[model samples]
Target: MHAIVIDDSSAMRMILKRIVTSLGFEATLAEHGRDALDKMDAADHRFDVALIDWIMPEMDGLEFIQAVRSDPRYDDVTLMMVSTESDQSKVVRALAAGAHEYLIKPFTPDAVAEKLELLGLLDPERVTAGV
Candidate 1:
């Protein structure tokens, strides 16, 4: 599976990339939402999933989710918010806006795996194997 990892912090992006790669996804990194969109638009490849940070420059994760969902070409892409925004309202907004899953910052690899499994993005064997 192909995934996009978008965040302003390079460290955070690296961590997310590592986690997703271990889960069997080939990842593309973006500094922010607009950059992510540009990368997606420029490439012929269609991503299977996007892990987005909420408070980013140029565009935020919520807006990115809306933008992706609005485009029919990206309809099949699963969007997951990986943010520090853990408030109930924010979570509600993200889900209502079209994010398939939400993982707050400081998450464990197991948490990510569980979320991916819930999204039907992870292979059962991989999850069972604790990958």
Candidate 2:
């Protein structure tokens, strides 16, 4: 599957990319929400999933999710929140705003795999998480 990693932090993006790649998915990086949207607009490819950070200088993850969800072209894309915003209300709000999954920051590779597993994007028994 093709996934988009939207985070202002390059290190975070790298980590996400590595994890996504390990899971057998292709990942594209975008520094912020606007850049991500621009890339999506310019590309012929549609991402299967979007892993977004909650905070950014330009546009935040919630805004990205809302924007993508509002557009028909991205209606089928799975949107997940991957950030430090682990507040229950925030998670609830993100889900209410169309996020398919919520992953807290500093997550282990296995946690990501578990989320993917629950989302049906990965096989639960096949995932080796601690990597």
Top candidate on TM-score is: 1
Worst 10 residues of 2 by lDDT: 122-131
Candidate 2: what lDDT? 0.90
For residue 84, model 2's alpha carbon misses the true position, in angstroms, by 0.5
Model 1 TM-score, all chains together:
0.97
lDDT of each: 0.93, 0.90
**lDDT tens digits by residue: candidate 2, 50-115:** 999999979999999999999999988889999898789999999999999999998988888888
Q: Per-prediction TM-score, please?
A: 0.97, 0.94
**Please, what are the lDDT tens digits per residue for candidate 1 over residues 28-95?**
99999999999999988899999999999999999999999999999999999999998999999999
Error of 2 at 113 (Å): 0.7
Off by over 4 Å in 2: 128-131
What is model 1's C-alpha RMSD?
A: 0.8
